[model samples]
Structure formats: C-alpha cells, structure tokens
Target: MKIRVTGAFLFNVLCTISYTCCGETVGKRPPHIVMIIADDMGSNDLSYRGLDQITTANLDAMGFNGIIFNRHYTEPICTPSRAALLTGQYPIRLGLQGEPISAGEDRHLPPDVQTLPQLLKELGYTTHLVGKWHLGTARREDIPKGRGFDTHYGYWNGYIGYFDYETKSAMTITSEVYEGFDMKENFVDAWKDKGIYATHIFTEKALDIIDAQNKDIPMFLMVGHLAVHTGKNGMVEVADEKTMNNTYGYIADLERRRYVDALMNLDDSVGRIVEKLQQRDLLQNSVVIFMSDNGAQIRGIFHNGGSNYPLRGEKFSHHDGGIKNAALLYSPLLEKKNYIHDHLIHITDWLPTLYSLAGGNITSLKKTDGVDQWLSISQNKPSKRKNILINIDEVKLYSGVIGYGGRYKLLNGTIQSGFYDSFTGEPQSSNKMDYDIAAILNSRVNKAIKKSKVPGKHLDEALIRNLRKSSSAIRNNSKCNRGTEKYEICHHFCLFDLWTDPCETENLIRQKSKDDIVLNLKNQLAEFWNEVSPQTNKPVDINSDPAKYNGTWCTWLDDEFCIKIKTNNQNKNCNENNRSTSSIPVLKL
Candidate 1:
C-alpha cells in the first residue's frame, strides 16, 4: 500500500514536469517589463553600490527588494553598448567597432537585425524610449518610431549642454556650438535664460509617458537618462575639494550638497515612476531594471565629478571601471528578497530576457547575441558564460587559449594609458613592465614594422548572421576598411585576488598565474579575436572642413585621426527670437 502511494506521487510530479517541458512554463503567464538605463554612470558610482559620499536612497531601496547582479557588464562606451543591448549581438559582429554614428551624420539600425523593442511590439506590447538615444543618428532616421520603438524622445547627439536652450535651439539647425554650451550656460546664463533645466525637463517628460501608458496593453519603456553623461561644455571644473562645480557631471563633483541635488532629481525620477506603478497597482506585476552604459571619465579637470572606486579606467577605454555597471531584476514573482545574485550579464542580454517574460514568441524572432537568462534566474541555475570577453580601443586576443576558461574580466591597454581610479585619485601603476609592450611604445619609425600574423577566433554562423544585420542597419550601405586598427593583448584579469599579497593590490596577469594558465587564457582570447577581427570598424561622417582649423582649439588629438571640429554658425530668423509658447507638458517617469 505504501509503495503504491509513493508511485502515485512520483507519477504526479512527472506529469507536472511534462507540462513545463511541453512549453506551458510555470503558470503560463507572461510578465511586463521596464528597462531603465543611466548614461556614463560607473560600476560603483551609486549609493546602492556602497558609495559613502553619494545618496541614491530610492535606487538603494530597489536594490534591497530586487536581486542585484554584482557583475553586470556593458561595452566600453555608449553607442556600442546601446547597439549591443538593442540587437542582442556584439558590436564587432555588427561592424560597429567604435562610436555609433559619425560626428555629423545619421545612421540607422540595419533593417535585417530585429531589435528587442520590435520583437516586443510584435508580441502586442507598447514600446517607448525617453532620454539619450545615441545608438544611431535620428537626424534622418529622426523618428525611432520607424525602428523598433512605438514612441521615442531624446537627443540625437551624444552630449549637449543639458540646460543650454540656446545650444538646443541651435542643434535643430546645425550641430555646432555657440559662445557657450556649458552647464553654466543657463546659470552662468540661466540667471537670464529664465526657466529651463534639462535634467528637470527630461524627467518630467518620462513620467508623463509612464502615466499615459497606464492603459490595458503590456509595455516596454527604455528610459535612457543623460543626467550623468555630461553637464555641458565639458566636465565641470574642480573649483576645489569642498565646492564642486557643475559643468554637468553624471554622478556629481565634490559639492556634495548640489551633487545630492542632482542625485535627488534622478531619484525623484525613479520614485515618481515607482509611485505611478503603485497608483496603477502594477508594482507587483512590473519587472524593473536599471544599468549604465559604461564607466565614468575620471581624470583631468573633470576628475572629481564621480569615481568608480577600485575599478580601473573610465569611459571609452576597455577597463573594469569603463565596462562595469549596476544591474538588477525586480519581480514580484520572486519569493526571495535582499539577495545578491553574483553572476555576469552583458548589456546585450536585455532583449531575449524581456521578450520571454512579456509572452512574446521569441523563437520566431531574429538572432541575438544575448542569451535568455530568465530560465536560469527563475530556476536559480548557473550562468551561461564560463568565459568572458573584453575589447578596448586597439586591443585584441587569440583563440583556444586554455586558462581563459572559468570567470575573468580582461583589461587591455599599453603601459602609458593605465586606468584612472577616481576614489584613489590616481592612475594605476605597475612595478614591472612587459618588455614587448614597452618596445612598441619606445619607437615611432614609420618604415620599420613587423607584421603580426597570429590567428584569432571565428564567429559561428548564427552570431555572424545577426551581427551582419545590425551592422547593415546602422551603416546603411557603406564599405569600410579596418586595416588601420590595432589592439593590445592582456590576460582577462578584472581585479585579481593575489595569494601572496594580503592587501590584494597586485594584478595577476603576469605576477601570479602559472605559465600554463597564461598560455590557455591566451588561446581562448585568440579564439574570440579570430571571430571578431574580420568584422568592419565604425564609420565617421563629419560635414565640416578639416582645413578650416590648421592649428587651433578646434582640433582634438585622436590617436588614429586628428579630429578637427570647426563650428559653423548661422543666424535664425528674427521671428524665432520673439516667438514663444508655454511649457510643453512633460511626461512623468
């Protein structure tokens, strides 16, 4: 009799497993999603990440309630990060080896690659993007509505003096600067510009969108904020340690009070969104996510704006400081709280995860570089990546290298360009030197060169297909030569924990690893490189004349190309100055 009862119980469990395997997952119910991204906020910039000086209470609250991923990652910079997130494909795969659109032009997502939003929209979910949209130029592809999103609002360019109405007005005509595109352009001029602050206005607009979307259909809102990207003009001047000024830094400078103000405004934006969810009684049903595009720039006059603490380097460089950021998953479906899920998730993973939760049929969807983490999360399974990959400006690796397996975050840059740590207030230093790396830096004779012939990894057919689609969308139809690119090689060492050094300050790349481990990592890196090296690099399209500034402040020393940006100003009609209207309604959250 006892055996018969036990057999009956086993039979019931098997039946349940059969139902799930047949695709009737869980209760077979879909979940709603909201993904919020912050621009240029470093991995440790927020209070939630344990910053003592800053206050991000609301985000902290969210962190407590949701599962925080300590190892969330993004591409080294803005555009490529966004591109990766949108297409679930690698930037190199899409041939976007650098910044998204060129200086003064428009680029579109290749029509072939299917973006996350388009997939959700097809599944009957409403989609919207508010705040910074730098993945491509909206100049001609002006309306993102043409892409995957159902609604969109934000700047087309990377940075604008946040509060500079004049510059904003100028952008509508030409992408040039005025006498001032400074954050103080308003306060420095705001005393006269009347009432306008980009931070305040953009937040208002987001909330408005959220409030109006409270109807019956499920939704997907990609809220990318420019709060911390840059204030304007450039990074704020370090007036002094006690009084930090705002040129418009992402986190804030030393002026802890005002920094708190800017931080509060961002929190206010989040709080309002939370309130909307509660008011609509949708808090429990909605899945909220937040992250940053890349590491914050932590050097020079812009030094004090914010810090990534222990992480090395800043935005644009491939370092932990530049590539790491906060990531979270908030769902009422979870039975746990105050948990830290120590796993690695890349920016490109958003599409598939959200699509699956939203009841979207992703099987028929186009290819993506990101793996669906939903199954792992709900079941508490292990991570998909046993090996992680990284690429910075002019860096490369080889394939089948052994020790590269397991978990690691690779950092690559020549000795001269070590990463800067804002909290430590210094550029990282090493006692020893790579004789090979130093040799390349020691000379500059154009005629004497040794061609490197190491083979890199090759992409699988599926990854190649989606990458091509994403690249074609943004590049339109342009052929680019990638022969000019160069990359430095380094072990995938994010911040190593050395055995001999108790303080753990040493980098394990050359110090602690066994010779065999190093060889293996090299091989794995080579495999990744082979797969990505053949890809096309980014395209630049500046409409200005380079000859205009033979030797002037208009020129920036780009390693590969001396980027010369000359301003061309034109007068607006007299009617424009006098014409005015009431404030446009701002969308909340």
Candidate 2:
C-alpha cells in the first residue's frame, strides 16, 4: 500500500470557522467533519422529519439549516449498515451480510477493507469514536482503537446491568464483568470500578479529545451513541416486568422510555460537543451529520416506538422502516432550509465522499470502497451510487458476482426481511402505482443479487439452498452450511412502491400476476450470480445436506451461532431451574 500525501495543496488548514456561507472559501477552510449517529432513532420519529411525538430539536435545527437526505438507505440493521457506512461499499461486499455483528466472535472488518476512520487518520486528522461499537468486539485486537480510531470510550459489547460505563482506549482498557464483551470490563464494573455512565464519559472524552488537541492538524470525530438502541434502562422501564409502574401509555416497554431518556441525555451531549466546537471557533468549519445506525428495535409496538410509520418494517427485516434512517447534515458549506435529497444513497458511499470532502488522495489508496460525492451534494447532482445491495446469509455479496450497479438492488431468495416506503408518516394508500411497485420489490432485490455477483465466495448461493431445506425430513440433504441460519417470526418477504404505495399493507407475494415480475427479477438476479461465480475458487461446500438447514431452531439474541450452543451443550439446556437460560432469540441469515 503506497502512502500518498499532497496535503499542502487543496486544503487551507488555517481559516477560522464562520456562520452562514458568507462566500466563505470552503476550499480554504476544509471543514472538520463530525458524524454523530444515534443508535435507533426511527425514520419518522425525529421532529424535524415530521414526527409530532418526539422532538429532536438539535437534529431538526440541523435539518432546518443544512441538507436533510430523505432517501438514505442502509441494511435495515445495525452491523451491516455501519460497516457499509465506513467502508464506502456494500456491507455484503465485505462479507458483513448478516446481523449487527458476528455472534460469539470478534468479527473485525477484514484487514484489507477501507474504513472511513482509517482514511481520515491517514489523511492527518485526529480520529475518535465514542459509543456503541456493535460492529466488532470480544478481543483486544477487535477494539476500535485498533481500527483507525486514535481514541475510544464506550462498551465493547451490547448491554450491561443497570448504571454502568466501560471503556477501552489505545493506551488503556478498564475491564468489568460484562456478559457479552470484555467480561473483565462491565459497565457495572466501570460503575463499580470507575463511576461512569458510558455515555456521559464518552461525551466527556470526545470533548476532551477536541480540547486537548494542538493546532497540528484538523479533526474527524465520530460519536456513535449506543443509547436508545437498548430497550429502556436509561430513560424508561425496560424489562417487561418493570412495566408494573404503569405511568406511560404502554407500560410494557419501560425499557423504551428509559431508552428515550438516555437518548434525550445523548442529545445534550451532542449539544455540548457542538458547543465545544463553537467555543473553539470550529463549528462554522465543521460538518455535523446525525442519524441512527438503523431503525427502532421492535420490542413492543410502542415500547421504543422507533416509528418507521410512513415507511414499513422494523429491525431484523430489510424493510424501508428497517434500513431508511433519518439523517441530517449541517455545515455552513450547505444552505439553511428543510432541503431534502431523495437521491438513493447508502452508508458505504460516505467512504469516498468523506475523503473527497477532506480532500484526501483516495484514487491512490487500494482499500477504499467509496465514491466522492461532495460536489454532487453541493451542486445537487444526480446520484451515481449502487443500484443494488445484497447480503447472502453470513456472506457479503458485494463485488465479484454480487456487486451493486445503478437503480437496482439484488438479494438471495432469503427475502422475508423486505423493502418498502414507510419513510414518511403512515400512508393513505390510494396510490396504487406505488403499491404495484411494492408488490414486486422482493423479486427485484432477489434478481438484483443474482445479477450483481461477479466472483469470489459463493456462500450466498449455498445459503439460498439451505433455506429450501427447512421442511426437509433429514438435515443431511441441506446445503453444507457450517452453521444454522437464524429465523425471525412471521417477518415474511414484503414489498412497497415508495414511488406509489409507501404503507406496504398490500402484500404482493400472493398476487397472481406477480409471477411475471418475480420471473423478470429472478432472471436479472441470475445475471449477477453468474457474474460472480463462487466456482472460480472452487469454494468448498460447508453443507452437502439441504435437509440439515435447521435455522428454525431457537437460541439467545436471534444469533445463529447460539443455535450450536444447544447441540454443543447437550447437558446444559434452557431450564427454569437453572439461571443460565437466555431469552434472546437466535437470528441467522
């Protein structure tokens, strides 16, 4: 990997921040980018986006002034989208096609992949991450500090008992007893070991990172808050049993209100981070982007109420509600208004865009999977982003046979996690045209996946075969899948025509003539499949028995890896008498 540095040209490292464009020579002041991401703020829940119930004043103000992208797309889940956002390519492209992060493994992003933080770090900017890092965990090497981030302060795993904050940094890692992550470093241990609420501490660390810096270079701070992602321990009652207090409308989701309270507090942290920048006279020269990793977790209908209302679907499914997050970008470089860009942009595109905005030499870097789109956003240019995004269970279907093109998305036959238009409030649905499109989206995605394939691992094709083995009498005939697939409830393959029917009420799978659309899409899918043949490498089959695909079996946290626990721990099973029993459902791709 050749290191290219032409830093003196194209960027003026000395201009003070400004308010309003004021013809501010942005090129001279190359803005400091601060990407703030909320864990699970819903698509229609933010006040700026037209949600009446919740008030995201900070985000709304940012949207009111800067550019609000109306058509942002992710994997409708956490880990994949976050990976895609940082990589500037499809999560599938990088083998991160399933779940938020890997189950029971310290699944670091592949070493060869391009990461936004790494790119910025190489470009001479101080990079930092503070908050949930569901992307990878379980090992010291898998921590964020190792992944281009110069500093980090947050939990390595998903959750902890009441009142806790844990941290791992480039210099030191404070360990606590956590069930999922660094068992040595629990928030309670952080609370017990070092009185800190992970959120507030991270905020302070982020602010401190900004303050303790000298004027040697600019900064790129990514505050990926983990609040609101959990059911409600921070703001409201979270556990079902805790809802006995019964103060809110729906008491079952106490975890949700606590989640909201935690979120509200996080907003204050955002305000503080912004204020620090302003105080340093850098806000004017900084670009602030706020959004969630994915849609709301559907704990209870209104528990967290991470509303995807006008859109459809929730976490775990690839519906609009799941993938289309509410995003706002603020910069003096951008105009002040409720400007919305409906162009289709996914998380990965940010890789190149961030580089372009930072004026980095991306062309000479082999790890990048992004496209520079700053000029496009500033000039209102059309999107040239990928048309398709596909993730074959446990495999990233990007590049080779499964890459993205334009105006299309491809996917394996695993289509239950759907796509739709719940982006706005609830739909009125007289628009039969959109409904018509909704009916065909699944087939379209499947077709897209089939056509996007160019070469490399053929795990997706094998996973598709495994799905057909669910009802088989014996497990031996199933695809030689190394692990069992995870299955959610009746999260059936759904469709919606955002161009016409956004509600996604009228399912098109049963439609008689829908076969034509399905067939057309399947053919397109085949094109991509042949394009990226797993045969090139003679990829060894993991499963030869299509009948052995036992994804329906349950386990903790909807993670497929947990399924093997039952088989592995034949002596130890979920028992009421024993406390080792876990309630989390195993979800496999």
- The sequence of per-residue lDDT tens digits that candidate 2 reaches over residues 265-382 is 6666766676677666666567788878778755432235455654556665455567767777766564322346656676777777777666565576675445566655665566
Model 2 TM-score on a 0 to 1 scale = 0.64
| Residue range 388-450, candidate 1, lDDT tens digits | 555433333311111122244334332234434212332122221122222112212100111
Span of ten consecutive residues with least summed lDDT in model 2: 544-553
After superposition, the stretches of candidate 1 with alpha carbons farther than 4 Å from their true spots are 1-29, 100-102, 106-108, 165-195, 236-259, 300-304, 361-365, 392-406, 412-416, 419-504, 511-513, 533-571, 582-589
> What lDDT is reached at residue 212 by model 2?
74
Clashes of each: 44, 97
Q: TM-score for model 1?
A: 0.67
For model 1, the run of ten residues with the poorest summed lDDT: 445-454
